[model samples]
Target: MFGGVSGKGRTGPVLAVLAAAGGLVVFGPAGGSADAAAPCAGRPVKAVGFGAGELRLYKGNGYACAVTAAKNPGTRRRMSVTIQARGSAPAGDSGAYTQLAGPVTVHAGSRCVRATGAIAGGGSAQTGWVC
Candidate 1:
């Protein structure tokens, strides 16, 4: 399983994490510098960059997860992340955040998956389709 979030941030930033046992772990705007790491299990398979951040995808054990991490994290800003398995509705998270957006996930048992993310309303999309 993947460990704690890791991205740009201040030293000794606050953190909150849950066990990545096929579940979602969300951290709110924490104190001091707004930087944290990406939280998810599995090996990274694909990533798409944006103006201010990036969308990363991971896969393992027939499951996949996605994350949107900001390149610069300090001020409160808009962020969003989405992941969708083919034939299923997409899952996403968006709001004013200091650091990152989501670790949106899906069960991709032999199916293709698409992920999208944005920081400050600017971002990119990916059709990994890593079947």
Candidate 2:
């Protein structure tokens, strides 16, 4: 019944799972599952708003994170988030998501960052850099 049972127990929180598209995806009951936190790590640094949603940034322990949060979530839609550290290649995420996208992280110790986000058909981006 589980997506792909991987745990040791049968009726004691099996935690069914499987790797898909380079990410670990979990399968749960019909309504939804628990622990569905945003994909990023660290404390929020900034939030850039757009027509459909907002781009959120976070920084912690010498790393930077980014996520695109839909203003009104629930429906599956295209979402994306991108962040680029000064003198470093950009890191980002884009796909069909129910509420948000990304959590794209990159090493950004003492460096400025620029970011962009898109949801549905709307988009937003940072014109300059910020730390």
Per-residue lDDT, model 1, residue 69, is 83
Model 2 TM-score, 2 decimals: 0.67
Q: Residue by residue across 45-88, what tens digits does model 2's lDDT show?
A: 88878788888888888888888888889889988888999999
Please write out the lDDT profile of model 1 over residues 44-94, one tens digit for every residue: 888788788878888878888998888888878888888888898889998
Worst 10 residues of 2 by lDDT: 15-24
The segments of candidate 1 whose C-alpha lies over 4 angstroms from its true place after superposition are: 1-38
Candidate 2, lDDT over the whole model: 0.76
Q: Which residue ranges in model 2 land beyond 4 Å of their true spot? A: 1-39
Which candidate leads the pack in lDDT? 2
